[model samples]
Each structure stands twice: as structure tokens, then as C-alpha cells.
Target chain A: MSNLPNVPFLKFIYKPKNELEKGGRTEIPAPRQSSEPERRCPNCYKSVPLSKISANMSMCGCGYHFRMTARQRISLICDTFEELWPGVVSNDPLGFPGYVKKLDTVKVASGELEAVVCGKAEIDSQPCCVFIMESYFMMGSMGSAVGEKITRLFEYATMNRLPVVGFTVSGGARMQEGLLSLMQMAKTSGAVRRHSEAGLFYLTVLTDPTMGGVTASFAMEGDIIIAEPGAMVGFAGPRVIEQTTGKTLPKGFQLAESLLEHGFVDAIIPRPEQKEKIGKLLMMNKAVN
Target chain B: MANPKYKSAYEIVKTARSGQRPTGIDMINGCFTDFIELHGDRYFSDDRAIIGGLALLYDIPVTVIAIEKGHTLKERTEHGFGAPQPEGYRKALRLMRQAEKFKRPIICFVDTSGAYCGIDAEERGQGSAIAANLYEMIGLKVPIISVFIGEGGSGGALALAVADKVWMLENAVYSVISPEGCASIIWKDIKKAETAAEYLKMTAYDALELGVADEIISENGLGGDEFYTMLKDKLKAAADELTAFDGLADARYKRFRKFGSYDEITIETEEHK
Candidate 1:
């Protein structure tokens, strides 16, 4: 009913009525067109058959990496994950209109109660606390729930003397929660500091499109920060920058390689090698700690 | 004519937002002597938006870091309108670390609309840079005093503001988001920025009441000889107080930990009613 035009694709994806009526417990049906055998890479505009991309963890041949859900990322990286604080859910602190409903839709679609999943896991026998941001859940924006989960994870790691590993993919702070969402930056950063003060290792693996408040906080506070090849990692998105500066950005402006050149990223590891590389890093950190 | 003594939140916002207001450079020059400018984030190109250096505050050694807004339009654009990119923050961190290593107290001048929100800024990890500063600053083993000189907006402001003692000039404003941004988000109208400014409680006085700022330095009608002298005296006193503390890192950690401390009470419905 609003004057703004409805996005057809989003409407199809977020059919809230059907999703909420089911109490967000079951998987919503994928869009009708997605039933086809091929899945297009949104980044490179290349279409690869579902089977091929699935085998490669949805990475395209042209080197564009599709986003992975937190569960998917954890499954790929950790040998075994015992999820922590699964009951921590979001409340609309600001009482923003329709926020709860939107959260329900995302919850059902992503099978995630919150944007991030934290757990104790082993990477090639190196035990560490892992937190994976679920990009599928509201673009992995940090709200109070996400902040609480991450803070608790850090505290848990500090108490147990375990290293902390974070996989970050976010669009920034959740707008629905307003200032409460912004406060997460400080809270998470404080937690990271405490973890660091304890002489525990903290590593962050930035994936495709990690931006906003998450980038500013725990994502960047890592003792060692690694990124996926060609991931967009920065504070502001390109479109916002283009609009603000009123100029076309240079090609590959926020790419992981560009960040590496800028000294923001330590290394760019491909998905195929991420598990091995992380395991090795954890092993090294264990020796140091 | 606008009343200088008792201005509304909107008036204060306008005055603080004015380009005529004194910038970080002005404060550094007024309060400190023998400044040696430092540059570069060492990771990438040096961001001119933030400038730092070793300086003397009344013959006492210190490091000065400031968000610089240029006087002219050309200068402003070049300086990114005082909004720091990731490199600017990294540069600040680099300098802060240097100051810590050399056992110099740090005096930071905040004057910016916010961090740069451009694609290139984000691509380079603007958030991470700001966050890293916050994470590192809380435990830095040196005295840090941050003064909000003009507009201090959003996490960009907070990034540089995690100090042992945070002071603000009388007319300065600090908030999680700019008034215009808050207005747009809250009311879906940018024109309601004045209302947003009032409700955001971003004035120096408001900050003092909220315990976010330690003191408010009254700059009677912008910067003058009197205002500068008072500011210098205050800075010296704060630095001296901080240096006297034995466990500075622990105190700094506790200072940031207590920020935004509050209590919540839930009302229960009466059974009889």
C-alpha cells in the first residue's frame, strides 16, 4: 500500500504470511525459477549447473564466490561443531514496525535463529571457538542477539583458554534495532579486547561482502585476518559510495586482493584451502599460546 | 541574531555544523607547541583526513592526533570533509602505539561529520580500522585525552573517543548517527533533522549528563585567547591526573567498560486492577 514499488523478487523470496503461519519451523519453498538445474553467480553473472557449483561450495568458475550460510561455512571449516546459545533470539527493542515479522521470514528461510552461529569446534585437531555469520539471515547484520552471541563466545573462549576463530559476512548493523544495533560494535570490540588481553588468539575469515559495523568491530579486531579471494570487505558498500562521491568507483575497489594491497587483509585464501590453512594457523597459535 | 549564551539544540547543531567553527588544527596550534607531524598508515597511502604528530602541551611531551576539516571547498574535498577513511584510523592507531611506546600522553582532537562512507573507504575496511582503534585504545599503556571540538558523528567519533578522559567544546555535538541520518531513519524525512538533533541528546551538556564526556570546555563565541588558555590548562591538568595513576591500562579498560551503564525495570500489572 505504500507508494514505494514492491520488489518482485524480494516479495517472492519473503512470502512472510506463509512463512510466519508455519511458525518459521519448516523450510520455505525456493523460488519457482530456482527449480532449474542451473544457479547463476550473482557476482560474475555466470551460470553454472547446480551440481558443479554445489561440489565447489557454490564458487563460480570465473572466481566469484557465492555466499554460504553459517551452517554451510561451519560444516566446511570445522570437523565437529557443538553450537552454543541456540536459544538466544532477537527482540524488537525499538519496536520497529514489522521487524519481528521480517525476522521470522529470515529465520525460516535461513534456518537460523540469529544472524551468527557460535560454537566450539576443532579444525584438524586444533580446538577453537568459532563464530560464523549467516549472510542468508538478514544479510548477517549485527543486532543485539548477534552481539550477545559473539560476546558470550569470546567470554567462553577466554574462560576455557581456547582460540577464537570468526567467519564474518555482514551488511552492517541491523537498522530495525536502531542505536541498540550500533552499540554492538562497542560491546563486541570490548569482548575482543578482553580475549586479546588474555593472550588468546583471535582470527577472522572475511567472506564475500563483509561490510558495515561488523567490519568495524570483531571482524577487524582479529590478531590475524584472512579473507576469501575476491570478497568485498569494507565499511560502506559501493553503491552508497558511488552516490555519496558522485563518481564511478575504480574496478575491484573493495575486493579482498585490494584490501590485501591496502594492508587491511593478512592473506586471501581460497575456499578449497581455507580449512587446511585455518587448521595450520590454529596449530601454530596453539604452539604460541 | 542568534543568542550565543542560550542556544537551542537546533541552534547548537547549526553552529557546530558551520564550516567557520575551529577545526582540530586550530586547537592543536592554540594548545600545543613544537609539533612534529606524522603521516601514513604504513599499509596504504596516508589519509590526510586525520593528522597526527608529536607535540608539546605547555612544554610537556605529548602526541596530538586530530581529524582535520579544510577551510576551502577544494581543501575539504581533498581532506574528505574531515571524514576519515580506514587509513586515517590506522594512521591514528599507528601514532597512538608510537606514543605509548615513547611514554607520551595522547591528546586527540575530534572534528568530523563521520567516517567516510564511500565504496573505496569500505572496500579498504573502514569499519575494521575504526573497530581496531577502539579495541587497541582501551588497553593502550598511556594517558589519552580526547576533545570533541566540532561535529562528532557516529562510530567514527567513538573510534577516536575511547580515551581516559573525554572532553567536549561547549558547542560540539556527538551522536551515534548524524541528525540527518537519524531523521531519515526515524521519521523517513530528512527535513526533521532539527527534531532529531534535539531528541538525540548530542550536545556537550547532554553528553556530560549522560557521563559520556568528562567535562565541557566553554568556548565563548568560538575560539579566542581566553578559551584556548582555559583549554590548555584543562588538558594539562587531565594529563597530569592520568599520569599519576599506576595502573593506567586497567583504569582505561574499566573506563570503557562502564560506558552506557544503566538499569532497566519492568512494570508488572496489578492483580486487583
Candidate 2:
């Protein structure tokens, strides 16, 4: 302890990567870049080649599903996609400290203007409105732009009498936007309800780490809700729950398997089989125009 | 208790969470007569955190739902300190749907720190329950009004608050996250909560300015008969006005849809290129 106190620079050098508060910045290391040939799997710890992982829908050989970008997920599921409202961008409404800088950084890193990508697409010849949340963009936080895009998409779907498919992977509402981000929960849910009332099918595919406000809103408002294998889907994050309850959580407490056991999620579909499963459901529930 | 004419946002937050404040049961008993309390969500056990039932709002029938934080410690424990579980929300929804069946207006009293963060709540689909309310409430044909009598905490409060009109007491606070939680997360210190409260825009006046709430009820003679009587008059007036309007669902939809604030960027992208 005396030697550690003497080494002043050691504290800075030994800081943990996941610790966001110690560092003034909230920037996480960008997910596997294209330049990197192989990336270490968080689950299996095997360094898998990028091309092999991409070919396997970003899943490691050990069955750990890597988080895919919005575009990447779109390409996998949508046979034909026409992007909608690509020009919408977020503003620092609250003028929150460092918000614009954080947005810029994430925009460059994620190569997306916002966390969610909404578009009209076809899944196995069935037409639908689709939205894929970008996990790389601020951990898929629902800011104003994200909320507006999804709400607009749902409105469009309702008007067109089209089925809607949403893939949610969010940490929660973007706190930088303050209460506006929280209001998105009600906004998106209102749109979803309108779409549902129009007699259109809405299916939500909850990806890993779908928690907080998003979970408490449109992500859980689907007519049929499914989840990716081992996805964490809950209103409160496990850590927050543990802190509040002051009790140790069991293993895989909020995982998709656990949700399925508790009758929350309809099914836990693996990434590779998702397209077929979703396509079949879409095909079955085709709205009679 | 000192009733300051000018309370800071943090002070209002503190006051909203005070134990002496009128709970849901107290409000229900005060505002309405012949209240018949409804129990259970049918799918699960009745949650004590939420008190919902049918009541006569002056002469008109209305469904009343509120998140009750009990006055006594034993009562608080029974009510889970006003933090609702999934079943509590489900029970509220059940009463709401019943109100819709009878073409009755709905009035909700919101007071909660947030949803219950427990293993059982998660297992029972707390997220889904709140989401369901938001979805269903928007499309409900009847007029709905939510009054924030105390702390309107996050999604738990929002579950019962997707109303045509939202009101907040002068001392009440509605926030995305608690000031203390925000401080601890952002500053790594809980002592910065006062500053966090200022930035959060959680006060009733702030809520009105931000368009999150329509009106701010005064706290004059708070918890007294006159306070409840004035609130009842306002509730009746608002509900009557809302009931007269057509296309309520669409209005409610627009109310929430217009909440987002963002800028448009016409930069050359892959699509344009």
C-alpha cells in the first residue's frame, strides 16, 4: 500500500477500461473495427476472424452473438430496404455539458447519425416497416432523434397498413437529453398503440442489453415479443436491482432464457435462425390489404 | 413544516418525497365519494403499491388509480414505498380498461420514486407491464387525466400517466432519473444532487414550461379539505372538457408525439450520393 501511494502515475495507468466515472470522458473503445482482422470474443475468449464472424451473423463459433451495427443487422434481415428520414439529427436541446462532443464522437465511431435506423423493407417478399437500433451509438440510447425516427416509422406503417418489425438494443433513455428522452417512452408507445389499433402486426426482437426506458415502452409493446439468445431484457438493469434490493442476483437473472422461463418473451431465437423465424411470422401475419 | 413561497427545485423534490404528504388513499378518500376499491390484475396477485378503483368524480363516474406511499413505516413497507411492481401496473390497467368499457373518464394520482427494482418484479415482466399501459392508455376512448401529487418517478409513474392532460402539484417533481442517482452516476458524488435537480427540470413549473405537464396545481393549504376540493373542481372541469372533445386518442397521440426536440441535418449522405 505504501509503494502504491509512492507511484503516482500507476493510478492513471491502472484505471479499468469499463470505469466511466474515474475518467472525465464516457467514450468506450469502439466495437471491432473493419481494420482489425480478428476480435476477441467476450464469452469464449477465442480470437475469431472478422470475416468468419460476419459470415456467421457476427456470432462466435462458441455461440456468443456479437453486437451488430444497425446497417449490418438491416442487411442480414431485409431483402430490400429503403432508408427513411436519414436527414434527422439530434440537437443539444438542454445544452448539456459535453453532449455535442459525445454525439460527434459516437457518430464518427458508429458511422451513423443516430442510434436508430428506420426504413421500409421487405422480409422474404413480405413488406414491412423496420427499425434496427445501433448498439455502437451511445449504447443504443434513445435520444430525441432516435425517438422521432421510430415514431415517424410507426406512423408511416400505420398509414400504409404495413406490419412493423423492431430490433431493440438500448442501455436506456439518453440522459443528456434529460426528460425529453424519458418522454420518448410515451411518444413511441403512443405511436405503437396507434399502429396496433390500425390492425397491423408489430413484432419486437429484443437484442442484448435492452433495459430502462426503452424496455418500459415500445420495446415491450409488440404484439409478439421475441428475443435474441442470451439477451438482457428488463426495466431495471441487474446492477441497479442488486443495489436497490441489497441482495446478490442469481446467474443469468435478466437473460432471455430467464425471461422465457418467466413467460415474458415468446421465444429466444438465435441470430442465424432469426431471419427465417421472423420471415415466417411475417408471412403468416400478412395484413390483408 | 415550513412552506416557503419560493422553493428551489431540490427543495421541491425533498418536499415531494416527505412522509407527511397525502398518499393515494388519502387523495382518493378526499376527492371522491363512494369509492369501491378494485383488487388484482387477474393474472397475478394484487399489488399494494397501486390503489385503483371506480369512483364518482363529482357526479360523473371515473376510474381512479394512484401509487400510494403509506404514511406509517408499516404502511410504507406494505406499499413498497410507492414503487409499483408489474402486477400493480396491471391492476391499474385492468381498472382503466373497465372504465373504458363503461365510457367513464380516468383520473390518476402519481407518486413514486420509480418502479420496484426487485428480482420478482423483473421476473414478472415489469417492462412489459409499463409498456402495455402506455400502449393501451393512449388508445383509450375515455378522457384521462394524471395529477402528480408527489414524486413522478420515471417509467413507473409514466405507466399510469399517459393521460390526455397531465397536472402536477407545485411541490411535486417528475424526473427521468432521481437527482441523487444522476449525481452519483455523473459526478461520482451524491452531494451534487441539488445541482443535478436544477439541471433535471423536474419541478412542476419546469414540467409546464417544457410542455410535459399542462397545469401546476397550487400547494396552498396542502393536504387540507380546501386543497382536495379545489383539485376535485379542476379535475371535474378538465375531464368534462376532455369528454366533450372528439378524436381523443389522436389528441393524446399528438400530445406525446410533439415531445421530441431535434434538429434537421441535410448533409450529403450515402442515400443522396
Candidate 1: give the clashing pairs.
Answer: A215-B128, A216-B127, A216-B128, A234-B122, A235-B122
For all candidates, state DockQ relative to the true structure. Answer: 0.26, 0.46
Off by over 4 Å in 2: A1-38, B1-5, B271-273
DockQ of 2: 0.46
Which residue pairs of candidate 2 clash?
none
- Report the lDDT tens digits of candidate 2 across residue range A1-289: 1223457788876655544544434354546655679989988899988889998898999999988888889888989898888878899987766789999999999999999998899887889999999999999999899999999999999999999999999999888787888899999998888788788999999999899999999998888999998788988988888888999998889999999999888999998888888999998887776
Give candidate 2's fnat, 2 decimals.
0.75
Instruction: Evaluate candidate 2 and give its CAPRI docking class based on DockQ.
Output: acceptable
For model 2 the interface RMSD, in Å, equals 1.8
lDDT of 1 by residue, A13-46 (tens): 5544554554453455557546668877877787
Could you tell me the TM-score of chain A in candidate 2?
0.85
lDDT of 2 by residue, B1-273 (tens): 112367788998999999999999999998999899999999979999999998998898889999999999999999989999999999999999999999999999999999999999999999989988988998899999999999999888899898899998888998899999888877889999998888788888878888998998988998899999999999999989999999998899889899978988775655511
